[model samples]
Target: MTATTTTAPTAASDSGLTYVDPRAPRFGQAITATVLTAGVVLAEPLFIYAIAAILGMALLSGWRLDLYGFSWRTVMIPLVGPPERREPAAPHRFAKLMGAGFTVLASALLLAGVPLAAYLLAGMVAVLAGVAATTGLCIGCRMYQQVSFFRRLGVV
Candidate 1:
């Protein structure tokens, strides 16, 4: 998902929080779920590696550099028009980083010859992403919010 910086007029939110199109994260999750599922189902390292690379870029740089976000802005938006609302960008960003960590760990497991374990991890991530994409209930994002809350309460 793309973050609404001060420069993006369309991304401005009344709360002044960084915002993202409400649909972008869901679309990104859909792509993520599909890619991870394909990697496990097809037993293809290439698919996993490709997703790993994409997520790595997002984790290292920002969601603005993510291929999924780019695709959403360039392709999906053109076909579907703009989203009706925006959501806080931090939770989605946290989710992307968490997903990246999972993929990276899965890739390592695959490289270490633990294919079953790798597939299981990737499959779990796929299921989580699928749920998020279809239902707009992001577990990782929820986890982020909870963690943030706990941190604020000095309970983390």
Candidate 2:
């Protein structure tokens, strides 16, 4: 007589998908951020454009464009938690990095007396992010990989 062995699969293996796909989270964050940013643009009285841009970056980065909280529990509540599989792609690290960078840049510009530039950059970032969300492409992630490859060769 022989006994059979049974093993439980881990969540990562159970998902039957890679942990990082570089598109899904970015798309979800983008959509969530855009809606909130649009509200901010409409309600805020000053630096509307610049604020909008900064908010746009927040949307792209999966961070709260608002200066309130910075936890996944907080960020994910309204952004990606509900409707669990709306976007199937795993969040790309590169997209998150770029989104954070853009958000910071826009914020600095807003504070540095370059509201127009901030606004424009933010608008462009938002538009590109929106397009990517709709079309399932991540320009930021592609650019990051390209730059990383060159940097490894000391070419910057």
Best by TM-score: 1
Compose the digit string of candidate 1's lDDT tens values, residues 1-156. Answer: 434434322244455577778788888899889998999999998778777888889888855577877777777777887767677878988988888998888899999999898889889889999999999899999999999999999998
- lDDT for 66 in candidate 1 is 79
Q: Residue 53 in candidate 2 has what lDDT?
A: 55
Q: How does each model score on lDDT?
A: 0.82, 0.49
* Candidate 1 stretches greater than 4 Å from native: 1-16
TM-score of each: 0.89, 0.51
Best by lDDT: 1
Residue 79's lDDT within candidate 1 is: 82
Residue 78 displacement (Å), model 1: 1.6
TM-score of 2: 0.51
